[model samples]
Target: SMAQDAINRVLVDRAREGKFVVRLKGGDPFLYGRGYEEAHACAEAGIPCTVVPGVSSALSVPALAGIPVSNRGMTHEVTIVSGHLPPGHPGSLVDWEALARMRGTLVVLMGVKNSPAIADSLMAGGRSPETPAAIIVDGSLDGQVTHRCTVGTMATTLTDRGVRPPAIVVVGEVAGLPQVLTRA
Candidate 1:
């Protein structure tokens, strides 16, 4: 809930003072991390800032749980969206209906609180209620848990499993792929 502009000011101020600053952010900054925005702010303030790409949990979390986003004939697409704002929210631009119609994996970031709404919208948009679903909580950290269920039971599974923020939700056939498609 921190303001980007507020942090931008500090970055600019420190750069002006010739203080070398390194902003370490988990995951790829451009992948809904607002890292580009920070770089833009630095550029606008005439500060020389560089953004180093990092691994994104949207892709890594599922992989950590042995879910390949795309495999030969498994799926040809992988869609990642932020569930920070539930579907239908004025601030949300995600088209849950269109996503529901797509064939591939759907990964949601920061969607713990809106899992219910998200599942409901996808089902209402024509996605099968029995569609496979999984939530990788506390991804890449100690005690990480991968909760499995169907899209229909996502809401309940999340609650029953005690899923929380900083989790990645995977919906589609890929969610059920808990084993490496191949080891070669």
Candidate 2:
């Protein structure tokens, strides 16, 4: 977390110097990137910090791969979760069981390394093993790769494909949406 600490310090220092500082980040900063911490630091120093909204990979990545996180009459809810913490970790706040019961799209970020445990937790928590799943690597950029599989085989499929971080994992019916309909 040293890098983040350094970032916060820089933001505070620049704001204190009465300079406008823009901390550009990939996706929505607040999603899981600790944008709030930086904002809080600025506030504590009585500095003005304006937030500019940006696209999040949770939605954009899937769309780029011709997968919609939600579709009319197909799915109305979408849940985005951080896979940074493995299931059952003491510090983890995500309710895997509840997420498992949700009948909607589940988009997981930074979960590539822990996909097996995540998939296991979902299935154990009542999610169907056959649920359609997809992994979009290096999404929204050139050299992006999309791999489709069932929840039961998601981890193995990712491994077989040599999938890595900076990927989005979409689960549910939406992941299996017809390609023809999604083509722009």
Each candidate: RMSD to true structure? 2.5, 1.8
* Candidate 1 residue lDDT tens string, 1-184: 5688888887889989999988888989899888988899899988887789998999888887888878789899999998999999999999999999998999999898998999999999999999999888888887777888999999899878777787889999988765653322
lDDT for each of the candidates? Answer: 0.88, 0.89
lDDT of 2 at 95: 97
Predict model 1's lDDT versus the native: 0.88
On a 0 to 1 TM-score scale, where does candidate 2 land against the true structure? 0.94
Query: Which 10 residues in a row give candidate 2 its minimum summed lDDT?
Result: 175-184
In the range 1-184, model 2's lDDT, one tens digit per residue, is 3688788889989877878888988888889878899899888878878888778889888988989899999898999999999999998899999999999999999999888999999999999999999999998777888899989999789888988888899999998877643432
What TM-score do all the candidates reach, one by one?
Answer: 0.94, 0.94
lDDT of 1 at 113: 96
